[model samples]
Every structure is written in structure tokens, then in C-alpha cells.
Target: MPKKVVYLVVLVFFLLFHPPVFADITVVINELLPTPSSGNDWVELYNPSQNDIDVSGWILDDEGTSSDMLKIPDNTIIVKQSFKLFYVSNRLNKDGDTIYLNNGTSELDKYQYISSETDVSFGRYSDGSISWNTCSPTPESANSNCEVIVDPTPTPTPDPSPSSSASQSTSTKSPTPTPKATSTTTKSPSPTSAKLSPQVLSAASESSLILASSTSASTSPIPSMEATQSALSKTKVAGLLVGSGLALIGLSIGFYFWYHRVLGNPKKEQSENKT
Candidate 1:
């Protein structure tokens, strides 16, 4: 292969996989301590990109003529999203000054500020932001918190919970009893028995029927299981009502005797007076 074509092929391969030469120029003068209270004054460089940066010939300087600029060492590689620190001790003006970064040619970034407090460092918010703030010196690490531009993000509306499919149990309905095809003859009203009125006799007949139904219900071979239980319940209710009625009558008779015993009987007193 030709020499130029071979060289071109190698360059293209490295570029495709992100070699250091073609990395985007994203390095910024991140942090700097102008007024150092304890240690020497320092400046920090940061590369906030995924690809490594070859900041070999980059320059760091304050407001001075040609002789005062500091040149980065050759093959000085700053890995992605990392920091580099240089001790420009006593170089920065403690009162106030501007710091500049250059790629041996055009300027990369610069920061100008008024006088800084003692031991405080000024830098972009996180690393490469335009906004600057001051905090305790954080050399070769992140700057103190004032570089980022945060817009308020609205809280996402929570999705409505899906309605639960509640399983509603249908109530077991008591089935209506079907009538037989055979004719149902009404009993002819019979003469009153033992001075009982016809209405009372009719009621007595209905009571007898209810009792018979309840008694046979347990042993009766009914088709539906529910119908048998319903008949049994009806029988129990009728028995309870009859028992309550008898108890009420007994109580009424006992109360009549009690009243006569407690207070003197008016009829007996009248007869004694005549005597």
C-alpha cells in the first residue's frame, strides 16, 4: 500500500474508536485559588468529555506579557472527566485578577473576578459551566457548589391506579316453588267449632298446615337443597311465635292474681260490708 493511504487508514480507525487526537476541545479552567492562606496558590483544569484530551501545549497565565505564561508538559493526557492541578504559587494576585487557558494558539477559557477571600477558590459550578462561585479550595477535585444551571422540573403526575375488579358475590335467591298441574280445591268453610269464629278456624287451619310443612321439611325429599332449608326456617319461626303467644297469656293470668293479692279485691270488700 502507498504510505499516505496507509497513514490515512490508521487515522480513520483511531478516529472511529475515539482516539485522543480528535477529541472535542471541552477542557475548561475549572478551579483556581488566588488568595491562599496556607498552601501555595493553584489552578485546576478539567476535561468533562468522554474521550481523553491531549492538552499538551495548553497555556495557563494571568494578565502578563509573553514570558509569564506556563506551558503544559508534552504528552500530558487528561483522562475523561478528570482534573489536573498546577501550583502557580505566588503567581496569582491576592486582591483580584483574570486567569486564561490557551491551546498554544487560540484561547480556550478564562475567568475574571474581584478579590477573593482567604483560602477560597473560584471555579465554574461543577466543572465546565459558565457560572462561577467560591468555596474552600478543592484542588484536583470538584469545585464547591455554584456552577450548575438547574431549571425547575415539574413533578410527574402519578398515573391513576387501575380500578380493582371487585368480585361481587350474588346473593343466593330463594327460588319460588312451582305449582303442580293438579287442581287445588278450596276447603268449604265448615261450621264454627267450640264457639270458635270462622276467621279463627281459618287461622287455625293455616297454622296446622305450617306445622305439617315444618315437620315434614327435614325428612321431605326436596329436589333443591335451598328449598328444604327455607321450609325448615319457616317452621322454626312459626314455632317461636306460638311459644311467645303462650308465654304472654300465662303472664297476663299471673298478673291478674298478683293484683288481687297486693290490693284488696273490690267485690269481696263490698260483700263483707253488707254482712
Candidate 2:
């Protein structure tokens, strides 16, 4: 009976003095949707701790002095390290606003914005991180990295002109070839024997006939002077031939006598003795 009372007192002290577990819950306002297309605006909450947290009786509001707030229903559980979305009855502002999340007793988290882009949300770049960025709307999920990609435009190339092509052809052309010098050779004449005419006989002829003709009439004698001249020329030619022949005969007789004188003539001596 004594041990039971002491155990009861220890239980009461632990129950009363220990701080409430719900107050230490870690829940953050991760993403916000200020402008909606056709429904009430909403805010997403995330519990980053390892265990599930009870967010019942939690309050979400914008501009602390206004009536734009949402009280969570009882028995609401935000799963550990997960996302939970809550609709806020068109409470957020498109251009600028401030938001708050509290456990009905103490403030848990707050966010402020100057402007929100259309069709997008304002949230932490990495979930549970203090750095904020404008990102695509991700309800009840992890936030996305903020990035923009743009396509580059292509540039066109210009076509070549006729004048430019002609200029290039002219620049690459070869020079004209020079003509070579030609040489000429001269030929010498060969020695040839000349042909003699009838008037200038080449062979020897001692005697020939002489004829005389008179173009004009002459009355001196029966024979003309030209005829007389011709007869005399003929006679002189005949006499020269006769002289040449007699000289040859005389040379022969002289040679015969000279031979007899050198050698004895026995036959001529015998004939002289008989006479």
C-alpha cells in the first residue's frame, strides 16, 4: 500500500510538470496559392519531423489584423515528412500579402510576399528550407526548383552574288604563255659543169667549108669581095694543115736516117758492092 501511493504521486508529477507534446510539433507553411482559377485559394503545410504531428485547432491567416483566417478541424493529422493542403476561402492577395500559421497558442511559421506570379505559387525552393522562390504550383507535394529555359533563334547565311564569283575567277586565272623564237638555216650551191653552144666548139677541127653571102648588090667582078675574102681564108686554113702534115713526115725520115747511122746497115753495104 505504501509503494502504490508513492508510484501514484510520481505519475501525477510527470503528467502535470512535463510540457505538452503537441506544442513541440514541427509544422511549416511550405507553399501558398494566392490566386485561383475557379475555386477557393489554398495553402500547403508540411511536417518535416520523423513522426506524425496533430495540427487540429491550428490557425492559418493573412494580415494578422484582418478576418482572413482558417481554423483547422479537430482530429487532423499531418503525416511525418509529408504535405497537407487546406483551402482558405479566397483569403490570399495576388499582388502582395503576409501569411501566418499558429497552433492556436504559439506562432509556428510566417511568410511574406511582395507579388506572386500568375498561375504559380510562392514557396520554399527546397522543402523546409528558409530560402523562398517563385515556383510552379505543387499542392500536397514537394516544392520545385525555380528555373526558366528559353529557346535560341537561328541566324541565316547570305547567298553569294554573280559579281563576287566573277572576281574570284579573275583572281585565280593563269597568265598567257610566251611564244618561242624560230631559227633558219641557209644552203650552199653545188658546183656544176657548164654546157657549150654550137658556136663555141670544144673539139679540134683543122679544115672546114667557107660560105659568103652579100646582102647588097656589087658590080665590081663576077665574085664579090666578101667571096674573095672567104676563098683566101679557106686557102690559108688548107696551107696550115698541109704544113702540119709535111712537118710530121719530115720528122719521121730524120728519125730513120739517124737510126741507120748509129747502127751498121749490112744490107745496104752489100748492094753497093755488087753495083
Candidate 3:
């Protein structure tokens, strides 16, 4: 009957149009390698999905600056539940540098680090689309308990003036009352000059130099403690969301099947008893 045909058509349409509950690829930044005083940085990518994903032709770039491009090899295939590490050739990006992952056409993920320090971002890629979240830079994401902390620079002390000792000594000398009687006599070179300590001057100069160096390092841009903490929070939330979504979807499917099995079997039994 036409009604049967219409029912079939509706079923077909529903099957075709329904959104899939499972994702194709899940990419996570598993690790950010140690940054040396100079040289390149590496980003580790993990494929958590069951199917293999070919990252060939994929590009990794640093934010708006496209000059630094990492190309995934044509033969590159991220096996199911495996990891791949991509090394970024660019050295320390000044401040506020962003690293982006793309597949020639669309951006897959983006991470921004406060300039001069090592920070990172991560995301997932599916069918040319990117699912991404920003994270505060971490020493490494795989190990959440461990973090990188930049030590505060020591404060500098002011250098003592050479004239201070001479002034102190002059102040201590008693004043002669007869001005004309002592005028013709040769004045003794102050004993204070010979008493001036070489060790004291050397120590003062060294302390002043150390302070100056510390001041310069302190002024250099380093991520604040609060900013680092914020970045970690963001990353943790993102990881939980990505890792939990599939598990939730699986649970939903299992519940749906159980519900149908329970109701359908009970209804069939009642129909047979009526017969």
C-alpha cells in the first residue's frame, strides 16, 4: 500500500539525515617537549580514535605568522590509539605567539603562549573541521601535577660612593682653634686613605653588578603565576570534555538498546498470550 511505501520512505530519510553519535578522529596534544635555551620545540599528537587518520598534507603553523610551517608527510598515518610528535622549527617566539594546526583548508587547532615562555594549546580534527580549545601553557600536559615555574630575579643593591669614607673620617677630626698658626704647616695626608679597605670595595662592586643583572632578567617578560594557573584550568576542562564525550555517547546507545529490548519483549509476550 501507499502507506507502507510512505513509511519506508520516512525510515530511509531518518537513517540518512540522522547525525552520527561517534567521532572519526580525536587529536590531543599529549606533550610539549622541553624547550632548551635555544632551538626548536616539539608538540606530541595522540590519536585516541579507533580508526587510522592520515595527517598527510596537514600543516602546523605559529598563529598569524605562516613562515614556520610543518608539513605532515604523505605516508604519515596516525594509527588508532597512537601518538605522533611534530617539532616546530621556530625558536622562542617573542611574546603572545600563537601556534596553529591546519589542513591546508581549515584550522584544526590553535594554542597561544605568553611571549617568551613555553605555553601551548590543543584541539581535534575531523573531516577538514577542527574542534579546538585554548589551554594555558604547561610545562607538559600529560603530567598535570608537574609545572614549570620561572624563578624570580634577585633585587640589586646600590653601589656605595667612594667619597663616603673620606667624608666620615673628616667629620671625626677635631677642629684646630688657631687658624694662622697652623696655616704654614704641611697637612698630613689623611690616615683614612691608607685605612680604606680594598675587600669592602670589591664586595660592594660585586653586589651592585649582581643586582643590575637581576633587574634586567626580572624585567624580561615571564608568565605570571595566575596566567599559568588559568592556562592549566582551561586545558583540564578541555581534556575532560574530549575524553568523556565518547563514553557518554556509548552509554546512551547502550541504554537505548536496553529500553527497546525490555519493552518490545514484554509487548510480544502479551500478544502471544492473547492469541
Candidate 4:
């Protein structure tokens, strides 16, 4: 009958009827090992949230068109921040297949693979990124724990066959000629020897000039390592000098302003007050 008692009763009723704030618990298909080395095809579910989720009524199926939902076993619970591997004992399509995870009414996650290599998994990464090549077969482990599989041996390319004409030529090839020894007779030069023709002499002179020019160009001087080191040292010293000068200038400007504010202002204020 009292006012305070009535208000307390009303507050209690409101508190009891208010909907509870549930945590965001998302269960994602973290990893899929459709073609494992020894076991049946399994999919790993990751619970990244802090709250424990009950997957007892959840359904997992490969049915894209028909009702082929496999009911999760009773008492099926995935603890908070853990991975749960569900085995799909049925034969999965190696060429391509679609996998769907759902509750009775709504779908949780859906993954479809176009093609998957044997013993290689195609699933999401730790960051929930689904890519065919980025994910590897982890089976019972977390998606992040899966190592990227890289084939070290490169694929061998088939050698091109030789043509019929080329094969025949190779089979009937002639042997390489051996060098035959010949005696050399040197002609002694005499002052009365006939002089070379003018055209031939001109051509020889031009070729000699070209050879000299090329030799000079190729032998042009390049900067030595010591010279480069000296230049770098000079540049570094110049930079240091510039930086020190700028720092000194900044300090001078700051001191000028600080002195005017601290010492000059007080004297001017006193003079103004006196006036």
C-alpha cells in the first residue's frame, strides 16, 4: 500500500520481463579437409566468441537442392574459443561440391568448392578469409594452425620432338675437318717493293684512326671507389653543418621570444601601472 513499496514492485517486474542481452556467438566453417590422407571428410567449426555455443540442433549437409541435412548428435557442444571437427562420412564430390551448415531455420555458413586436390584442404583462414589456395588441409586443427603447402618440385615440361628432315640431317652429318699442316714461306720486304695502291692506303689509315678512337673511348676514366667515398663524406659533412645551423637559429628565435615575454613584459607592465 505504501508508495515506495509500489515503486519497488514495479521496478522488479520491469527487470524480470526485460530481454537478456545475448553475446554474439558466430560458428563459422573454419577449415575443410574434403580429401584427407586416411580419414573421412571432415569440416572444422571455429567459435571465435567468448560464450559457449550449443550446436545440438544444428544441421550440416551437402544438399544444395534437396533435404539431406545430417542432424548433429545430441549433447553436441562446442566450448568457447575452440575448434570442433565434424566428420561427413559420406563420399564428397571430388570435382566439386557445396557444403551448408545450418540451424533448423537459418543457415550459419555455406561453402562450395569447384575443385580440390587430394589431401589438400580448401577453407577459411584465421581471419575468416575463404580462398582456394590460401588455406591448407588442417583437419582437426584451427584454421590458423594450417600451414601453407608449397610444392618444391616444379612440373617437368615435355621435350619437343625433332622434325624428320632435321633428324635425317643429324644422322647423316659429315665429320668436322681436321686442320692440315702447311709450311709458311716468309717474303722478305725490300725498299724496291711496289707501294700499296692509294685507295687501299686510305682505307687502312681510316681503319687505324677508328681503332684508335674506339680504344681511347673504351679506356676513358671512371670515378674510383676512393673518389666516391670522398664525395659521400663531403655530402654528409655538409648535411651535418646545415642541420646544426638550423638548430642554432631555432634556439636563438625561441630565446628571443622567451626573454621578451619573461623580462620585457614585466617592466612594461610596471611602467604602465605607474603611468
Candidate 5:
């Protein structure tokens, strides 16, 4: 085998076995409703990964500015190939806007549109095509035809008459005197209610006594410091008396042994001298 051919085989094997690290899943903005009927705008993300991908620390930006970006919350996971709706707090431009989904320095996906319609979502068609258009906002679901969500609240019609002003003045004027007279009457009973407060104070005193007794029963008894000191002093006096008696007995036995050994008996010594 040629040396160059062996080297080529080894290089191919290494390339197949070892791949680059720091790999991340790609997510796209599947649908967006910039002009909703009554709330802040929302954007939906589509994760195509078979496993759940955590999009924590990801940023969604418009115009790629610091003030125009919304950082996704921590532990924000899109379950295996699912959709996640996020509120775009950066105020989506109703006329025309561009949204960019990025992680750190890497741009994952971007969607932009110029022709925006009110309450209509802009996204790709369901025919497996890459073309994006004004479709129904299917948040956390597949994109389809936009539905006309009618607001149930009736539009307030303005009364266009000089009497409308007169009626408002009459309504405002009628409420003023009624409350002041009622408030003065209501304040007189407050002192009467203060007489009832004594009953509440008695109840509170009873509860506090019960609490004190319960706490006292729960506590264990502790020895007094005076008792402990008296016990210690008695032990010391007993030890001292025993030690003094032992010393006196030892001294007497030692004195008798010294006299017999160092001084002779007088009668025995005189008998030995006569012999």
C-alpha cells in the first residue's frame, strides 16, 4: 500500500469519528401577531428538534438594538418539536417590523414583513412551503387562515347634546351633599363602638394568659445556680477531711519505726557488755 493512501484513509476515519462541539438546535419564528385586538403582541417559536431544546438565555430582538430586545426566561424549554409563545415586550411595530431570534452571537432565524394587517397573523403557509403571508394567528399550533375574532364589548356611542353636559352636572351635583350628611351621622356611632372594644380587650387578656401557661408547662425545669454551688462546696470539704486524717496516721507509724531502728534497747545492750 502507498504511504499517501494510508494517510488518506486515517484522515477520513478521524473526520468521521470526531465532530466539532458547541452544537445548538435551530428554532424559527413560526407565527407572529403584531396587531392583536387588545393586548401586547406575541411571537411563536417552532423547535424542530426531536429532543426538548432549552431556549434559556436566548434573545429576540427587533432592529438588533439593546432596548428592542427581549431576553427569554431561564429554563424556558420547548418540548420535543413543539411551539412556544412569547410576549414581545419590545412593542412590535404595527406598520412594519423585523424580528430576529439569536443565541449570544449566533443568529438562529429572522422574519420580516412590511405589509401588516390588523389582528391578522403573518406566517408561512401550511403546504410545506417557505413562503410567508398574512395567515390566522395559530399561537402554539399550526398556521392557518386568520379568524375574525369579534370583540364582544360594544362600542360606546357619544351623546351629542347640550343636555348631556347638563345631565353630567346634575349627576355630579346630586352626589356631593348626600355623602357629607351621611358621613357626619356615621361618625357618631364610632364612639359607641369604642364601648364594645373593652370586651375585645378582655378576650385578648384571656388568650395571653393561656399562652403564658402553655409555654411554662412546655419548658423543662433547670437546676438553680445556688444549689450547684452548695453541692460543689460540700464535695471539696469532704475531700479535704479524708486527706488530713490519712496524713496524721502515716506520720505516727513513721515515727515508731525510726525509734526502733536508730536507738538500741537499754537492757539488751548492758547484758551483752557483761558477757
Candidate 6:
């Protein structure tokens, strides 16, 4: 009876405290891409695990601000061998960016950067302590004792003219006339050379003029075939994630049932013995 009770307790503890099967899955911030806009940056996540892992509830942070916690559905798995790109709204400032991945109450990985440069030190959260990655050294990672350090050289930023001065300059400058000589030489005659009747010409002048629009309107903005192929390759990663999530859900359910059955049997036997 006591043995059965002990077994049940152990099972409960395991369920409560033990890490998930794929908890060993490591996610590295492989790359950060800057967008044309300031807030529309993206970060790439690389799954360096041998098994598919679910990143649901995994938090992605920029600098110190918590952005989003990924709510990956069951059957949504990052494949054993794959790279996942997570689009982050906040831009990765060269000054610093800290990315932390946590599971429930425990943190799994913490990447701290003083400068978003070539080499940075990443720390792994293990046994409630941080283990820093120190092999790759940069100006920021020079301090071996510290988790991360900033580069001595400050991050370069584009110089902005004072708003008042800029506005004043703009107001003072005389508007230059569009050089008629250059315009006459550059502007080609319309492809449609059909002579318009007086009535048609009058009507056309009264209505909107199509050829007067900018030439950029005629160009194709959609991506080419090569770009489409690249996009397809990136999208294929979603399949890997989906498969991993399904497997995790299956494992979690199976473990729950198996634990209950194994532990519950002993409890039943103990009760029978007591009776």
C-alpha cells in the first residue's frame, strides 16, 4: 500500500515538474533582417534539434520588451532539420537586443547582445542557472565573466537635420522649374499615333489623361518565378512544424494515460489489501 502511494506521488511529481520530451530542442537566432520600415523587422529561428519540437507558448522578446508568445497548435512542429523565420514587429537595434525562449515557468534559452554584430554570447538556462556560450568572441562578448558586453564603438545612426532648420531651408529654397529642354528630349510620343478628331480631343482633354501618369505604373510589382520558388521553400518549413506538434500532442496524451494506469493500479491494489 505504501509502495503504491509512493509510486502515485512520484508519477504526480513527474507530471508536474519534469521537462517535456522535446524540451532539449534548441532554438538559435540565426539571422536578423532589417525591413525598409523601422518597426517591420524579422528574426530567423533555427531548430538545431534532432527531433521535431513545438514552439507553442515560446516567448520572443526584443531588447527587454516582450513582443509575442508563439501559440503553436498541436501537430504544428518545427522539423528535426529546419529553419523557421519568425517575423518580429520591433526592429533589432544595433545598440542591443535580447531574445529569451521560455517553457512555462522555466527559461530555456536567453540570448543577450550588447551590439547586433558578428559574434554574440548566448546563455542556456539549466538547473535554474545561466550557462553562457563563450567560444565566439566579439567586441561585445569580450568580458568573459559577464553574460554580454557592449562594443566600445557606439552604433552608428543616420544624422537627422534639426526639424526647424530643415523646415526653414525647405521654405526658403525657390522651386526649380522642370527643365523643358530635358523633358522634351526624354518624353517620347504616345505609341497610339491615331489623330484625334476635334470633338474627341476636346473630350479627352476634359476627361482624365492616361499617358500623363508616371511610367512606374506599367511595371510589374509581383515577384518573379525565382522569387516565388524561394518563398515556396521557406513555406515548406511550416509542414515540418505541423508534424512535430502532432507528435508532441500524441506523446503528451499517451504519457498522461500510461502514468495514470500504472500509478492507479498500485493504488487499487493497496485499497484492496486494506479492505
Number of the predicted model whose lDDT against the real structure is largest: 1
For candidate 1, write residues 29-106 as lDDT tens digits.
Answer: 888888887777888999898878888878888985556557889988888999999888678887778888888778
The better-scoring model by lDDT among 3 and 6 is 3
Per-residue alpha-carbon lDDT of candidate 6 for residues 209-239, written as tens digits (9 for 90 to 100)? 5554544577669888999998898888888
| Ten residues in sequence with the least summed lDDT for candidate 4 | 16-25
Per-residue CA lDDT of model 4 for 1-275, tens digit only, reads 69999999998997676422242237877777777678788777877776677787788888454765467887877777788888877446777788888867777788877666778787666535544343556655655545554546888999999999998898789677899975333454535344565798899999999999999989969999999999999999999999999999999999999988899888999999999
Q: Once superposed on the true structure, which residue ranges of model 5 sit more than 4 Å away at CA?
A: 1-25, 127-129, 146-275
| Candidate 2 off by > 4 Å | 1-25, 147-275
Q: lDDT of candidate 5?
A: 0.76
Candidate 2: tens digits of C-alpha lDDT, residues 1-275: 99999999999998786544764447889888888676878899998887777888889988846563899999898878899999988788788889999888888899988776666788886888877877888999888866432234788888966798798888789566789864322243334332333354533221221112232334355888999999999999999999999999999999999988767677778889999
lDDT of 6 at 16: 72
Candidate with better TM-score, 3 vs 4: 4
Runs with alpha carbons beyond 4 Å of true place in candidate 3: 1-25, 91-94, 116-144, 147-275
Listed in order, each prediction's TM-score against the native is: 0.47, 0.46, 0.35, 0.43, 0.43, 0.32
RMSD versus native structure for model 3: 42.4
lDDT of each: 0.79, 0.79, 0.62, 0.73, 0.76, 0.57
Clashes of 5: 1
Query: Residue-wise lDDT of candidate 3 within 185-204, one digit each (tens)?
Result: 23645465555466988998
User: How many collisions between residues are there in candidate 4?
Assistant: 0
- Which stretches of model 4 miss by more than 4 angstroms? 1-25, 127-134, 144-275
Error of 3 at 211 (Å): 77
The clash number for model 2 is 0
